[model samples]
Target: MAARPEPMTPTGGRLAIIAGGGRLPHHVAEAAREAGEDPFIIPLTGEADGDWTGFDHEPLFVGDFAGVTRAFRARGVDRVVLSGGVRRRPDWRGIRPTIPFLFRMPRVVSTLLKGGDDTVLKMVIDLIESAGARVVGVQDILPSLLAETGPIGAVSPDDAALADIRAASEAATALGRLDIGQGAIAVGGRVVALEGPEGTDAMLARVAGLKAEGRISARRRGVLVKLCKPQQDVRADLPSVGPATIENAHAAGLAGVVVEAGRALVLDRRAVIGTADRLGLFLAGIERETMA
Candidate 1:
């Protein structure tokens, strides 16, 4: 990890976490609270950790786009961090919209119908910014989370692992195009586990269990794919992994990590790499088409 810039004096006061889903949001909120800045949490309803007792302040839950904005506004939070995302698509069935959401239908539908993740996320960013709130990516708040440059394992790929890494990277992008998920674990050219709403850790646990049961090999020949959705809204739900992933792979007795070269975030890169290196795990930032 690069030397963290001395945290710019908390930009006045509290840190607002526009948390969606996954462990990263919880991690970020806890960090913000420990920094002496009260964290204003806005959980994405079914998508976030609504029981956020770790944070210094209360949390508000919003199930829709309109509600999300208003709840953040209510907190009087001008600075915010976009951490993680809810994995499931909204169940719009039987759901009624608020008047404002109804009024903004044209703009919202126009973007959703005509755009990909990037377009939609950019629109959300604009919406939040217009509310006198500055929406920032997790990087803006935690530079220490990004991975550093270099191979992270004690034993670099001895050819076989490299081959699996290449294959998994390609496969991940193919899966991503369908918005299936951002990660998968494979063994000897076969897909062993695909990440679901349970996220990476659960997937890792399952694969490890399979290995223990003699269903797969526990060696460098294993494959891991961390990728971005083909139609990603980079400003929002881009794929990210950190030291916990490395720790997971190690516990699972896996071989390597293959993340989308430019589009993925290797959160806590230095520590992740160091841990991977210590475990003899191979790490590769691979190109999609090339792997495909």
Candidate 2:
């Protein structure tokens, strides 16, 4: 494993997390607190799943730009982090834009209707920055969560598994370049599945179904790979893996999983390692260029 990088010092002013579904926002909040900063959380309605009982938090809908801006300004927030999964986009008609933003509503609607995930995220970042807060990536707050180079757990990929990894990595990169998805699955050096809007979990489930039906070779194990988009902003939606990922990969009859080192987030690191080890699954962090 590569050595962990030193933690970054939090920039001046209060930190705010635009939290969505999952433990990631909570993790970021904990990291911010550990760094001697109290973080205010704006949990998206229906999207944020965890209890935010102890943290200073406010609930807002997905498209409440005016409310989010007001909350940031009220709490003297200058650094904002967007984390976790948003399963669905908000309805344009339901969005509450600020006066200035309202003027740009036409463009916003157009982008929402026609743009890919990357384009939509860039627009969101622009809107957040326009509200006078700097949008930061979860990586900026907790560098240790990033996958380091080499094996993440005890098991290591074999030659065939490594070949699968390389194949899936290339496929994932292409998928990302199209602003489509971040994950791909391969078996015996043949790409089998590419993640789409339904996400990695659903994609893996598809693979499992295919395997069960004797479509993909039941004899040969596969590998799953996740990578950053070629033109991604990186601050909003970096690929993430966790214990669930290991479980899913095992269920999918995969031999291993690989993610781009330093570019993907590994949630609940110890748990992920334990799960990977228990399941006898190889979890490696590879450099994309090295694999190429």
Candidate 3:
């Protein structure tokens, strides 16, 4: 295990977590509290988990940009973290843009119309920073969530599995460069599936269907490769996997899962490892150079 960095001191004022769905935001809030900061949360409606009720949180629609900014300013928050999954874009018609949101409206509209996910995220980060708050990566508050390079379970990938890993990694990276998606699957050195906007679990489920339909040879299993998009701003939207990912991979009949070391989030690390071990699936994290 790597030595963990000391928790950041709370000198920059209270942290504001703009939370979406999944366990990550809850984890971030808990970690922040451990670090002596009472983090406030702005949970997006229909996206955030209910676990946030114990924290200082207000539920708002994802499109409520003005409301989020006003809440942060009112709470005297100066540092921010964006965490978790937002699978859907907000309904634009219902949004009532605040003055600050209006100032950035043109650029936001342009990005929404022309740019990809990464571009939209970069603009959102800019919007938050424009409100005079510093945006930090979730890993900054919870370093242990960052995956280290190496095998992480009882089973390790063999030579064949490693080849699949390499092929899948390259394919995933290429897709990422186009800002399309962050995951791909390779079986016997052949690309089997590429993740689209549906996300990783859905991609894996598709792979399972392929296997059931005999589209993928039953004799050959694959590895799922997930990485941070090459052009992605690492401070937000890092690729993440958890125990559920392991379950999905096993169901897909995959031999293992691979991720970029130090750039991906591994949530519930212990549970993820335990699940992989029980299912006889390998989980490895490799350096970017290894994929090249």
Candidate achieving the largest lDDT: 2
Q: Which ten residues in a row have the lowest lDDT in candidate 1?
A: 88-97
Please estimate how well model 2 matches the true structure, expressed as its whole-model Cα lDDT. Answer: 0.92
Error of 1 at 243 (Å): 4.1
Q: Name the weakest run of 10 consecutive residues (lDDT summed) in model 3.
A: 1-10
**Model 1 score (lDDT):** 0.66
Candidate whose TM-score is highest: 2
lDDT of 3 by residue, 142-186 (tens): 988888889987899999899999999999999999999999999
The estimated TM-scores of all candidates read: 0.68, 0.97, 0.96
Which has the better lDDT: candidate 1, or candidate 3? Answer: 3
Question: lDDT of candidate 3?
Answer: 0.88
Q: Candidate 3, residue 51: CA error in Å?
A: 2.6
User: In order, what lDDT does every prediction score?
Assistant: 0.66, 0.92, 0.88
What's model 2's TM-score? 0.97
